[model samples]
Target: MARSLLPAPDARGPFSPGFWRSPLRGTWFTSVLGVVLLAGVTVLFVTGLLSYAAYNPDLSPVNDKTPDKGILGFYLFSWPTDPPWLYRLTQGVHVTLGLALVPVLLAKLWSVVPRLFTLPPARSLTHALERISLLLLVGGALFEFVTGILNVQLDYVFPGSFYPLHFYGAWVFFGAFLAHAVLKAPVAFRNLRRMREGGEERADGQADELAAPRPDPPTVSRRGALGLVGGGSLLLLATSAGRSFDGPLRQTAVLTPHGGPEPGGGPNGFQINKTAAYAGIRADETGEEAWRLAVTGRSGTVRLSRADLLGLPLHSAALPIACVEGWSTSDQWWRGVRLRDLAALVGHDGPVDVFVESLQRRGAFRHAALRANQVGDPRSLLALSVNGEELTPDHGHPARIIVPAAPGVLNTKWVARLTFGAL
Candidate 1:
């Protein structure tokens, strides 16, 4: 008889049987942490989809007349104007949880990192696939988190545009996540159920998976490990939540990273992402005498001076121009000609979409598209004034489009023209 000298295999099932011998590495601890991160990622995906759907770019009409290329305007649908905070809440959760996950995810990874160095990492084809799934899960998560945080900070150190890159990456990450979920579901469910039943189990009748000399006692008990993860999450929330909420955190500028003035500036105001100078808008172009809002439609084209627009029926609405950068101003006293009123100049009484062109000659968002609902909403306007006074050039000056439930960029500042057509 011959015996070979080799360390025994340390292979264990998912949730890793006898994982509790490592205390902090207990099945309950890892499963719970995984579940929280999973839930956060799931919410981010859903909210992101909702944000994309709100973009609502159209298929048929590219321009007032047949045009060369289609405008992706990305202004396809007017997200609900009611509950103006809808976008605010979803985007807020997306950013906040994303930030919070920084610590939570690190902790989960730290707890499970030992498995990465496990001897004989794979014992079979099935095990090999499982390890591959782990690779996808970790890689995808890191990519999403890092890119997402950078985006919130408006740091474009990456090679391509943030929108397309982050978007495609999301699909890849979620695909791997779904695959990994299927592989780990049974183990995860069993462990979760065991924890609920007071966690005393020899499930599947499998013996413990540790050697006689078990791994060193964990420095923290399972409950303590959970507390550490949870406490880290709470600290992140406390420090960063001020970006969305108002209070001392904002004044002191604690750990809050999303920095900008509170929405409400200008002459009696609303906070702005880009001021007039920063946007490279010339002061002369926004002058009342120099600016003429040209309105074109299926029927005809008409140009209106500032007074001409003011002479037309005027209305006011309190709307919030919520920025995706995570700031919002409510109850803005926006006064302007109803977008439908401008549409009427060309006989467009029915549902119509409006194309808003801005005076700013250069910049990424110099023009915007108004979806049908926005054009029809009485609240939608080629705003002549905000908060009872003429618009400051920085606030879209002679004329700008202020539509309900629209992103600030799509609100179309420094608006120079409006083109109308069938929905």
Candidate 2:
């Protein structure tokens, strides 16, 4: 049997007769595939971090009133408070890249699987670290992709809470990813430079080795494998992207539960996660007579019923309510008092973080912290009506907080009280 000309140590560096026999396993092939996978992973990681910041804002002391204190959510800087489409783009990339990565990851894994059985396994400390890094990259990638796919699908098949598991695991995965990138940089750069220079040509004997006698080598050619992988990425993107850009692609996004036009019809027509009935809230209980929106801060306390709230200055904003769940509403009209104006009544003129409370007695996101940017935005509102109609019970009846560039959960539905400082 002929062998590969590519230099290597002994067992699995690169020059193996068996490895050369598979046309798809060529060094050039592996290098190119690896680059694609790398790009996808890097994009996912960055967008993932941005999404985390949008949710956790770890660096801010503003979240003192909330639960889950000091959880590694230490991301400082409030996310953008304008261009309401901010998270739509970031989280959309995160989820779509996650879906698109499935095939690329599978291909990269398939190509590298043979190395796992290399005898002696560890030739030196660096080799051992390389193996450890590989394990982390594999395990972390699989765990994250699997959990992400399932989580976005709303499947809770995992043993524990998806939030903490996914969150902490990301840090580990990213650390390992960085270490692996540093380790592989040398080989990767050389291989890439060779490919770009048209130096991808193999030596005389190497190409012949692929045609040598071998036991059932892969019949699929390199181009075929890449085509399959690319096809898969395109297919997944087609089926998932509509949740963000719900237009002509909506029909293709069958996998996305929230991807179609607002199903409720008219003003109320839109995707809903938690329904009023499911939330154990009754129509009778939410009557305006019983409903009151309270505003409190450093200045004083003010209770405003629906009529009183409507009597104040009202502004309407065209904003999208984007969520971490990988879906977003089209820009809809929201009408209510400007949050900063509301804050001004409470003696907050300067930049300040406000604690928004909701009537939800039990739920993870009942309350949220709004940073100065969100509070001060003219578009941020104690929204009384959506699309020109009073909020439906499912849509945070009475009033809700709608801030540009804020996560839907952080928008604080069914708002009850507003405390402007550390309370």
Best candidate per TM-score, number? 2
TM per model? 0.83, 0.87
Q: Would you list the C-alpha lDDT of every candidate in the order shown?
A: 0.69, 0.75
lDDT of 2 by residue, 162-258 (tens): 7767776787788888887776656666666866776543532345222323535578877798899999999988888887754456556787768
lDDT of 1: 0.69
Model 2 C-alpha RMSD vs. true structure (Å) is: 5.1
**Top-scoring candidate (lDDT):** 2
Candidate 2 positional error at 412, Å: 1.1
Lowest lDDT sum, 10 consecutive residues, model 2, at 204-213
How far is 1's C-alpha from truth in model 2 (Å)? 29
Q: Candidate 1 — worst ten consecutive residues by lDDT sum?
A: 60-69
Q: Candidate 1: where is the Cα deviation over 4 Å? A: 1-22, 59-78, 200-214, 245-253, 257-268
Q: How many backbone clashes does candidate 1 have?
A: 5
